[model samples]
Every structure is written in C-alpha cells, then in structure tokens.
Target: MTIDMNTLDKAILNRIQTRFPLTSRPFATIADELGSTEKEVLTRVSRLKDAGIIRRIGGNFVPGKVGFVSTLCAAQVPEEKLDLFARTVNTFPGVTHNYLRENAFNVWFTFISPSMTIIRDNLAAIAEKTGVRRILNLPATHVFKIKAKFDL
Candidate 1:
C-alpha cells in the first residue's frame, strides 16, 4: 500500500522521527521549523497517522534505568493459531512488540515489567491462554542501546 506524501508531510515525518520538541506545543515547534502553521502540521500528522505511516509516537526508555525489567520471549506457535497467539500476547500491557519469524520459535516479542516474577507470571498466563507451551524467556545481562532514526 503506497501512500502519497507531500513535501510538508515528509518534513514533518523527518523532524518528528528524532529531535521532537520537548515543549507544550511540540507541533507548533515543528511547524515553525518547517515554516508551516500548527494547524497545518497537526492536520498533516493526523493524516499520516491515519494512513498508518506512523505506528506510534512516544518515548523509548531503558527499562532497567527506570526500575523495570525486560526480557526477550520466543514461542513456537502453530500457523493455524498464529492470530490467536499474537492477539493473546498483545493483550498484555507489558508486551512492547511481537513479530513472526521464519524459524521454529516463530513468534518472538519483548516484554517489560517491574520484576522478573511478573514477567514470568504473564508468560505463564500467555501459555495457558494460547496453549503454546514452548515459550522461552531470555533476560539480558547487559543492554546495548542504539539510535533508530529513519531519514525520510
């Protein structure tokens, strides 16, 4: 699905991908930078979001630094139950994201919570709900943070 984007739309995307303003009127700031009005910027942003060009707009934090724990979880979900399994997993607020992989452990996701016990309990709940018992939880001993900005 290809979406048509004008120059201002592309500029809005590029600006917000990184260095988003830390102010009360962030869109206004973006508008000023792009030589557009806040209303125009907001309209464009809303259109882009509605078109699914932007999945989400939020901050990414280091779980450990913020008194939270994170782990990488993988599950072997049968093809027939992929939708069910993915939906059940996504219902948990701690699940950041999940994707299908071309491997034995086909469904993989990252989960974050205040403690490992909570994560384990959630994993157990997921297994019971989805009936996919072969779930692996791999906690990271060390974390490597990287910048993930796209040059739109």
Candidate 2:
C-alpha cells in the first residue's frame, strides 16, 4: 500500500527539500525556521523513516571538485549471484551507489576513484572477484546538469 502524507508530512518534506542550514545545531535551526522544536523535527524525521518516506540522512564528498574521480559501470551478474556480486562490489571503498537496472546489464553501480588508476584497478578487482567476464565501463559521455528544486 502506498503511504499518503498529510499536511505536516508535506511541511516536513518541504523543509528537507530546502538546503539544510549549515549550523552546529542544524535540527534546532530547522525547528526554529519551520516553527517547531528540535525534538519535533527529530521526531518527525524518525517518523518519516518509520513510515518509509525517508531512506537515509547523510552527506557525501563534493563530487569531481574534491579530486574524487567517478564513473558509471555495469556488470551482467549471473542471476543467482547478483546479490552476492553486488555485495562484493559494494565492499569497495569508492563505490557510492548500486542498482539493479532493467537493461541487459542488470547490476549497475557508481564508482568513484581517488584517481583514474585506482578506478581501473578497482574494476579489475571487482571483475576478478565476481567472475564476471563481461563488464561495461561506460565513462561519462555528457553530464546534463539539473536541479531538484524550484522557486515559486
């Protein structure tokens, strides 16, 4: 069943959609900005998580600008070993996200290398570990920049 959010949930999500304030007490600041208390925001975040509306709360290294090289790689993991292969590949320090896509290459993941050499070496290691002879390393061709928010 799909979960439908009410007004408060909408408000909470809107607060999240905006760039979270950069402050030592971010939750407290969010509470102040949203006309609520820190405990309220924290409780709502927990409720959202429990309701399966929010997956995670974390930050990432500034992509590209931080000398973090990244590329999209796909592998055709044997249907039975898909999970295992994905799990093994995920063990890499540089992998950021992984997915099971509908394309011929079912197991797709985003890998970031400290450098190009590490990227190649990590791919080689993943292939060896997974016994996946066929792999596609599609380096980024073009990045279409877009934003997720709009100003009304």
Candidate 3:
C-alpha cells in the first residue's frame, strides 16, 4: 500500500510521531509550528488516517507508573486458526500490541492490566475462546524503555 503524501503530510507525521502537543488544541498547535492552519492539518490528518498511513494517535505511558502491570504473551496457534486467535486476543482491552512471528509460538502480544491476576484470567479466556491452549505469559523482571520515531 503505497501512499503518496505531500510535504505537509510528511511534516505532520514527523511532528506528531514524537512530541505531540500537550494542549487542548493539539492540531492547532501543530499547525502553528508547521505554518499551516488548524483546519488544513485536521483534514490532512483525517486523510492520512483513512489511507492507513496512521494507525492511531494517542499518548504512550509507562504501565507500572500508572499502577498497571504488563506482560509478553505468546501462543502456538495453528496457521489455520491464526486469524481467529489474533481476533480473539484483540477483543481484550488489555492487549496493547499483537503481531505474528515465524516461530513455534507464532502469535505474540503485549498485555497490560491493573494486576497479573487479570492478565492471567484474560489469557485463560483467550485460550478457551481460541482453542489454543499452549499460551505462554512472560512477565518482565527488568524494564527497558526506548524512543521509536520515524523520520517520515
């Protein structure tokens, strides 16, 4: 899916990916910085989102700092049931990230909740719903944070 974006679109993506404005009118603030209008920025952002260039726009927070627990989960889903398994896992609000990998435990995701008990219960529910029983929940002992920004 090749998307043809203009300079303003590129600027918008670059600006928002890292330091999104912490203001009531974030789009307006971005427009002020980029010398564009609030309406134009909003319209461009909407177009980019519709075209799938932008998946979502929101704040990223440290789960632990916010009184939440997170874990890395993997499941050995058969190729035939991969789509269903992924869909089922995604139905849980705690699932922050989900993707497929070319490994024995192919379906992987990050789950965050207020406690490990909730995460465990959700995992059990996911297994019951998907019929993929061999799910592994690996909680992190050490935390590592990295900044990920694209130059686009």
TM-score of each: 0.90, 0.75, 0.92
Clash count of each predicted structure: 0, 0, 0
Q: Which residue segments of model 2 deviate by more than 4 Å? A: 1-4, 47-52, 58-62, 149-152
The better-scoring model by TM-score among 2 and 3 is 3
What value does the lDDT take at residue 148 in candidate 2? Answer: 61
lDDT of 2 by residue, 1-152 (tens): 35666666677777776587788988898888778889988888888888877755656555577867778888888798897788888799878778898877888888877777888888898889888877777766565546565322
Candidate 1 residues 75-152, lDDT tens each? 999999999999999999888889999999999999999999999999999999989999999997899888888777
How big is the positional error of residue 34 in model 2, measured in Å on the Cα after superposition? 2.2
Sort every candidate by lDDT, greatest first: 1, 3, 2
RMSD in Å for all candidates: 1.6, 3.3, 1.5
Candidate 3: list runs displaced more than 4 Å: none
Better of 1 and 3 by TM-score: 3
TM-score of 3: 0.92
Candidate 1, which segments miss by more than 4 Å at Cα?
none
